[model samples]
Target: MRITRYIVITLAAATFLTGQGMHRETAERMKDRGLSTLDSYEMLKELTGTIGHRLSGSDGYEKAVLWSQRRLKEAGADSVWTEPVMVPRWVRGPVEKAFARSGGKNHELTVCALGGTVGTEKKGVTGRVIEVRSFDDVRALGESAKGAVLFFNRPFDRTRVNTGEAYGGAVNQRGSGAIEAAKVGAVGVIVRSMTNAMDDEPHTGAMRYDSAVPKIPAAAVSTMDAEMLSALLKKDPGTTVTIQLSAQSHPDVLSSNVIGEIRGSEFPEQIVLVGGHLDSWDKGTGAHDDGSGVAQSIEVIKLMKALGLRPKRTIRVVLFANEENGLKGALAYASRDANVRERHIAAIESDAGGFLPRGFGISADSIKFGKLTQYASLLDVVGAGKITAGGGGADIGPLKPFGTALIGLSPESQRYFDYHHSNHDTIDKVHPRELELGAIAMAILSWAIAQDGL
Candidate 1:
């Protein structure tokens, strides 16, 4: 909680004198390096191209742990380690199919199984289809939904400027639609894709079941398919469909949180942590959702080493596991050892896509947060240098109770959902210059926090 780092840095910043002047000088050097550097871009390509999707408890995820551990050391982190964590494994079996038939016409819907959903028998579950706009509609139907396939066809609010906000408005149906439908004895549940884009690509995300409800099958229908089904339902009230989801859950698997740090020259125990989830959904390589974050976190240390600016506090970067389906990794890291959490001054996470850097979301008290605004403004050269209110990330949420200053790197949100959790979230979607800018933004802020106590 001491912030003499920013206070001292801001005073000598204009004059660029000594002490904190060295911090500014080194940050300027990092800025120049970021502009010309292809490291971030190249690193992301290697991960997405090679490792591909790394879902929690999958073989890909285990490989990602080893890959990240080696890469962290190769990036010149002073020390690297992994903490064991057990994560639930959800596997998508082969051939997921969902199709509707009405008035002798057939509509083959593009669909993928929602994470953590149970699989139907070999032939699949076919029954009368019930279309509902929201959970209220399902409740209204009440017992009428018994033994029927309930489709939650809520569309993202395209009117919202922030697509993330639009996704938030509609995603609850995807996350909780099954639980509600199950209460009404629904045998199957379908949710619309959580994206503003009206496309055939079905987005898959995490969904959980309330222990009291019987586990049932769930799938995400593409936005276009959702609209098609809705229209068809109106045309023929008794339209029916067969959903054959081959997904199943198995025993939990052992996973690891990839962690590394640059030991501080001064307060080595005080830590400023930066990270993103290493595990992604089992779709197209998760370049935007988190491959970008993993590479960017490691890139921060690389940039720091290149600049030769030793921090006053330990700079730790953790590539957490199981963020997509479960928070086991985040919780594990936060509770790993009491002593570690006690020394954690701040934790920053970059999980937003590798879009243009907008600004950072700072979460701290007025006094401590004010220091961040001043120290963080040094990133103004890159558009992502501003400081805003209300920030933290899912992977870092567990650290709040320990008095850790939680921060989230905000990026342009216009197109993030377009590729999120879908096949479009590939490495090709990431722009090199934009990715580097995000890495630079995090590096500058991390340096600021690492320069002293947070």
Candidate 2:
């Protein structure tokens, strides 16, 4: 329920491996408690079902903050509190419509505006649409794209084994499609949704403009709509589209980060943090994008309390705000105290989703990495102990620069992109059992770190 970091080492116990074997004992016991008695399903159900969409600067996010404070106390946290944060506010207007004319016919396309984008005026923008596969294609277009609506139709790379990698490859267009389009005097821009699944659902995410260049309206078209648009353009090169988006950005709004903790009996000052973002895009309930992580992070505290497993170091749970479009919450938490960098040892975040766990991505030097790999054995029975090379989530990403060891929970990624940032990301999409497995793994790791430390 809290976010912070600390590092503690008893040179006598951790000579390259402080309390190594001892940490495993507590870790194995936690795994047992997790598989047999722990349950985070109902909490997740209530979260996604009742709390609904928790977009930053929205009422839902405030309700989530209060719920987290109350739930953490009810779950028997030693202390729970909130830290103030300022977040940007973007309003999606009522009028969002687009139509393409080709072959003497008009076709309507499914679409949504990306976050942080500038909206069109009362009449909106219309121009001859030109399709491009990548930024390279945009560069090739040169002045040809001027005054046209740039349509970025790059699909996710199916060849990449890791779907996350595929998303990374295709995400830049959505992040800055409008900026690039405006560079060529384009009136507007349309990007293809970022998912492997081909469907009519349009996925929306954060986008930004460079003040140096003129700002333009931008939106995402569904994968299926993008395909159709591409085919239509091939048939008739002069096809044009009329795009409208009422979305607009307002001033900064006040928000807070929710934090709760189970005090360490031996060393209350030291901390081991686990967290997830509390905010999501406005389209869906945010079940997978981070609701799963928020539920499980709280469940991590609850599970530890239920088992009465007191670690030597404090276990803190944090629910960060504004991770969808900005790292404001993460940066705020990182700057909350000068000692955060000094007192916090390990920060683990679960933002990937609440699906089945495959392993953890541990970001640290060789000594710490080796120790975690050995401790990962505690997860062998549940099959989530594979430790790979990686760091923490976006909310906890800044902590890495302050000398804090960061870890991220990795889960099955093949299906995650299908529902992410779309209306399809509802409660029913999450499997109860798979969600618990992630918490179980996180709990074991947290307890192990508290028992010894990173």
Candidate 3:
């Protein structure tokens, strides 16, 4: 499973096209065919408005699985089915908010409880708010944070080239802040929404607690609200904030990963995988978070079949479930028997917001990726020419240990944070042309990999 083997295989397979003098014509044909079939607007509408939020273990997740199966089958994919996976179901109950009095005026703030957070007693918990920028600062406060609500006001660094990287740097606070704060006796936690843009929308995401640490209720405050709270706390350290969140977690439930495949005529046993998570957060419609990815993956299969492009390797599209609350769908799919794992050659995931595709983040070696770069000219027409050497989306990360060449589709991240995990991630936020360009980029890559046998 060394990465170099994939490169050798791809180069060997592609030699046939070049030797036969069909490379140029094939490229041109694919370019023409892909542009004709790529339609982002219709796909986004179908996924966001029609399918809506697809949280795993919920009814919406099941419906999305069925929708994917029907669409793939209608697209002339050879096979379509579901793979069972166990997923977590955390329900956001009646979440309400109140704030401490400052000069007799109550400042009402916007907030959403974090996923996997424990609910307060029916009466709720209220405590003085303490703001900290980083985990180190929280540790510095120590006992000072006791009986207080720890507010993480760190903002995404917009100066980074890739917004995803900026999100990665700042996300540890959101994911582990509660657990860290609880160690010293903090009663509750409030994280600044992970976005570069200043807005009132509070983003929600999953948080984890250490086994030994006490689990406390955690929520996210909008970036602007976080600033307001921080400013208030500076002036009046004793300012108390009252939070009432009725959110609760249900027992784990059975769910599934929807899969569809266009079997390769030459090498049905070898596979190239393309996918996106089917699950989304409860807020908004989850349109940009992953609805765009699911549609684009399906569109790849549709375009391939319509163009009469029979790949050398089986191209599979899997819509994973529970990517928001847990990675159950990815884990279950990866845990398949050894024989099934052996056939998988590559897995590409597109969970980034559905914006104009800038390039692909590849996690393979130079040689394998160099061979992949052969399609650079083909993708340039669709504006996905920037291919870097490092990446894989969360849903496909598990496949890497099994020697699968993993990739993440990189889209324009400028506005991704604006809607991610917020109420703004609705169908309207996504541009039709940008979504279509992403679909075309994915289709081109999938087609090239399938034909090249990797």
Candidate 4:
């Protein structure tokens, strides 16, 4: 009996080692193909240069949908299609002007209207500028805030090494500043742009107003201008700023989530999902924001096809719509009826900028995380071996309820916020080699999950 047990144990150990060796070999091949071809960068250049920014419900978005479908087909997806989603339509009209008058001098304040802000009249609104650090400060002024341009001048926290954390620490002022200011009868609000960089380029992002309060126009002042305005307010207590915005919110428009898949050889019903949002803010071409992610997601399909590495479970790539202003596409994809028949074992998202690959952030239980870390050896060659906790994208958040394991590709994030939601986020900012490394990392992890279910 002891001899038989030893024989069984030895066979099991050998089998495990053989599987690990094969996976390493496959990862090496993927790295070779990804580095030699640099297909992801070429695809990103075409998408960003040809289609430009794909804000939800715009002609550019529709063009991107068609382009994604064609690219997926070209990449050898067995099936490709679109799912309908209705998205909010907000346009930044031709006029968005702001200036501060202090000490009898007019200083132009670089600004852009936040998405979904109400437009000011043709004459514009001028009011005494009252700079406040937080909502508490706005309330403290009470009646003083009435008819004042409540400037939320909270600067992005620069101490945090993770720029995303720094953005999170300060972005609340931008998202809800208008509602809080309007509640106190403020006429308009000017938020400091959400970036650690002290540049003159204004960044625009989404903001909201409570229906109970009067709607007020909102804009983001450039970080440098925010500092200047703050200094002027200290020097001259009674500084007035004039702002005009022609931003308008129209009816919701129809859009679609682009999807393509390679069917599993064994468990076709089970899926390993990979995705990124297709929509972006209109300030720039969105090359880094999510264009890199979209290209990488599609390139997963290409890489698998090129190497002829078929998995035991399906690999689906979804380019989500309306992620900039809303997650309607994500919500639609995760709806009960849409997912009743499908079983998604895991979902990976690549929304971070096209920077150098560091590792992955995982949202999973300790058991699954431990299992995932076992594959770290395969990824260490590409410099993406680290796996941390609590990571997922806004588009993939909805899938959590379905017991699907969530993974986010974490790139080096120091420079991401400098160009985020601004005109600086352009194609030239991305490097070809860095972009391909990210794709290679994603492909290796995806293949591991598909081949050995977790």
Best model per TM-score: 4
Q: After superposition, how far is residue 422 of candidate 2 from its true place, in Å?
A: 0.3
lDDT of 3 by residue, 1-454 (tens): 7789999879876785473244345445655665565554676688677778777667877888888788878877888889888888888888656465554567877889888888888767788888788989999988888898888888888789778889998999989999999998999988899988888888999999898988888988888888888888777777878778888888888888998999888888888899998899878889988988988888888777877778888899988988888899888888889436347778888899888898888887677787666666666767787888899898998887767778889998888888898889999898777777787778777777777664
Candidate 4 lDDT by residue in tens digits, 233-275 = 9999889999999999999999999999999999988999999
Model 1 pairs in collision: none
Error of 2 at 87 (Å): 0.4
Q: For each of the candidates, give the backbone clash count.
A: 0, 13, 0, 0
Better-scoring candidate (TM-score), 2 or 4: 4
Candidate 2: tens digits of C-alpha lDDT, residues 1-454: 1222223344443553545566556666666666675457777778778889888888888998998898888777889999999998888878788889898899998999888888887777889999988877888889888889999988899998778999999999999888888888899999999999999999989988999889988889999999999999999999998888898788989999999998888888788999999998888899988988988898898887876777789999989999998879999998877455347788889999888998899888788887778766676656788889875789988877666778999998888999999999988889887888898888888888888666
C-alpha displacement of 401 in model 2, angstroms? 2.0
TM-score of each: 0.94, 0.93, 0.93, 0.96
State how far residue 306 of model 2 sits from its true place (Å). 0.6
Judging by TM-score, tell me the better candidate of 1 and 3.
1
Candidate 3, run of 10 with poorest lDDT: 19-28
| Alpha carbon RMSD to native, model 3 | 3.8
Order candidates by lDDT, high to low. 4, 1, 2, 3
Q: What is the lDDT of residue 365 in candidate 3?
A: 64
